[model samples]
Target: MSGGVIGTLGIVVLLVLLLARVPVAFAMFLVGFLGIWALNGWNAAMGLLGSETFTLASNPELVVIPLFILMGNVASASGMSRKLYDAAYAMIGQVRGGLASATVIGCGGFAALSGSSVASALTMGKVSLGEMDRFGYDDRLSTGVIAAGGTLGILIPPSTGFVIYAILTEQSIGRLFLAGVLPGLLLLAAFVLTITLLCWRRPELGPPGPSTTAAEKLRSILGAGPILVVVLVTIGGIYGGFFSPVEAAGVGAGMVVVYGFATGTLGLQAFWQASRESIVTTATVMLILIAAHVLNPFIALSQIPASVGAFLTALDLPPTATLLLILAVYMVLGCFLEGFAMLVLTLPIFFPVILQLGIDPIWFGVLVVLTLEMGLISPPVGLNVFIVKSVAPQVPLGRIFRGVLPFWFAMLVTLAILVAFPAISLILPTTMFG
Candidate 1:
C-alpha cells in the first residue's frame, strides 16, 4: 500500500482512539510508533522513539513551560489573582454588567500570569462566580463570562498554546508571543463589549453593583500592584529585547515567588503544593510534545502534507478563502477535541499548506491560538464551560453552554476582525523584532 494510504489509515485510527477516550499522548504515540514502523522499519521506529524522547526532554526552550505554569500557580495561591479581580471590581463593578466585565478583566489578568486556559478558567470561576451571584448578576452571564474570558489565557503573552505552536512549527517563540498581545487584548475587549450590549438590552441581567469610593478603588489597585508589575515586567522585557521568552518566564516565576513569600500568602506547604502541580502539568505537556514529535515524522514519511497541499492548490481557492476553510475545520474539531490535542493532530498537516500559501507564520500562530480559545468555550466539549459548572454546580450544564454562546459569537467576531486585518496579529512582532 502507498505511504499516503497508510498515513490516512493511521489518522483514522488516531481519531478512533481519541473518540474511545484514550489519552491524547498515548493515542498519538500508538499511532505514530506503528505508522513509523510500517513506513520505515521497527529499527527506525525504535531509534526515533529514543532520539526524539531525549531531544524533547532535554530541550532548553521547553523549560519555559514549567516556569510559566509555576508562576501562575503561585500567583493563584498567593491571592494575587483575587486581588487582581478586586481591583477590576472596584473600578467597574458598579456599572451594569460591570461585575461580569470585571470578571473578564480579571480573567485576562490571570491569563497573562498563567498562560493556561484551564488554570485561568478554574481559578477565575472560583473567584468571580460567587461575587457575581451576590451582586444579583444572571447565572448565565456570570458563568458565561468566566468560561469565555478564561480563553484569554492562551491568547495573551506567556501562552502555552503559542509556545506549543512555536516549538512544533520551528517558529520563533518571542515573535509569536509578541504577535499575540494585540489580538488577545482585542478579544478581551470584544467580550467586554458583548457584556455591555447584553446588559444594555436587559439591565436586569446584571444589576448595577454598589459603587466604590475613590479611596477604596485606590486601595484595591494598590493591592494588585504585585501581579500588575510582574505582568508588565515579563511582557515588557520581551518586547524591549531585555529578555528572551525563556528568560522572561523565569523572571516572572521568580518575581511571583518572592511576592508570595513576602506577603505570607504562600507558605512552605502551599508553595510545595503549587510546585508539585506545576510539575504534573509540565509533565503532561512534555509528553504531548514528545508524542507530537514522533507523530510528525510519521506524517512526513507518509507524504500526507504534500498530498493535502497539492489538493488545496488544485482547488485554486484564493488564499483568504483557503484560510477560512482551515479555520472552519478547527472550529468544528474544537467542539470535540481538547485544544492542545487538536493542535498536535492538525498542525503537521495544515502548517505546510499555510506556508505554501505565503501566510505569515507569526500571524497564523496568533490566529490558530485564537481558534483554540474558541474551542475551549465551544459546546459539546467546551472545557471551560465544564470548569465553570464545576464551580457553580447549581447552574445546569445547558445553561452554562447557553451563557457562553454570546461570548463564543464574540470570539467569532474577533476572529473575523483579526483575519481581515492581519496587522492586528503582526504589528507588535514586526515593530519590535524587525
Candidate 2:
C-alpha cells in the first residue's frame, strides 16, 4: 500500500478505536507507532519513540505541572476554598440566585488554585450544590452553574491546559498564564450575569440566601485575605520576573502547604493525600503528553497539517474571516471531542495557518482556551457538565444543557470582544513581558 493510504488507514483505525471507548492517548499511540513503522521501519520508529520519551520526561517546564497540581490539592484540602466561598457567598448570597452567583465567584477563586476542570467541578460542586439545593434552587440551574463555573479551572491562572499549550508551542508559559487573566474574568463575569438573569426571570431557579449584617460581611471579606494573598503573590511573582513559571508554581505550592499547616487545616494524612493525588494526576497528564510527543513526529511526516494549511489558504479569505470560520469549526468539533484531544489534533494544522495570517499567537492562545472552555460545558460530551451530573443524578442532562445556554451566549460575546480588541488578552502580557 502507498504511504499516504497507510496513513489514512491508520487514522481510520484510531477513530474506530476511540469510538470503541479506547482511551484517547492509547489509541493515538497505537496509530502513531503503527503508522511510523509502516512508513519508515521498526528501528527508526523505535528510535524516535525512545528519544521522544526521554525528551518529554526530561523537560524542565513540566515540573511546574505537578507542583501546581499539588498546590491545588493542598489549597482545596486545607479549607481555603470553603473560606473563599463563604466570603464570596456573604457578599453575593443576598441577591436572587445569590448562592449561584456566589458559586461562580467561588469557583473562579477556587479555579485559581485548582487548574483541573474536574477538580474545580468536583470541589465547588461539593461546596455549593447542597447550599443551592437547600435554598430551593432549581437542580438544573444549580448543577449547571457549578459545571459551567468549573471550566474556569482551565481558563484561569495556573491552568494545566495553558501550561501544556505553552510547552507544546514553545511559547512563554508566564505570558500564556498572564494572557488568560482577562479572558478568564470575562467568562466569570458572564456566568455571574447569566445566573442573575436566570434568577430574575425564573425566581424559582434560585432564591436569595439569608442576608448577612454589614459587620459580618466585613468579617467574611477579611477571611478571604489568605486566598487573595496566595493568588497575588504567585501571579505577581510570575509577572514581575521574580520567578519563572516553574518557580512560581513551586512558590505557590510552598505557600499553600505552609498555609495549610500553619492553620492546622492539613495534618500529616492530608499532606500525604495531597501529595499522592498530585502524583497520580501529574502522572496521567505526563503519560498522555509523552504519547503525544511520540505521535507528533508521525503527524509531521504525514504532511497533513501542511496540506490542510494549503487548503485553507487557497480559499483567499481575509484573516479575520478565516479566524471566525476556524472558531466555528472548533465549536462544532467541541461537541464530540475532549479538550486535550481537540487541541493536539488541531493545533498542528491550524496554528501555522493562523500565524501566517498575521494573527498574534498570544491572542490566538487566549481564543483557543476560550473555545476549549466551551467544549467543557457544551452538550453531548461536555465533560464538566457530566462531572456535575455524576454528583447530581436527579437533574436531567438536558436541563443542565439548557441552563448553560445563557452562559454560552455570554461566552460567545466575550469571544467577539476579544477578537475585536485583541488587547483584552494581550495587554497584560505585552506590558509585563515587554
- Give each model a TM-score: 0.99, 0.97
Local accuracy of candidate 1 as per-residue lDDT tens digits, 227-287: 9899999999999999999999999999999988987999999999999999999999999
- CA lDDT scores, all candidates in order: 0.94, 0.86
lDDT of 2: 0.86
The candidate scoring highest on TM-score is: 1
| Per-residue alpha-carbon lDDT of candidate 2 for residues 321-376, written as tens digits (9 for 90 to 100) | 99999999899878888888777667766888988899988888889888998888
Clashing pairs in 1: none
In order of listing, the candidates' clash counts read 0, 0
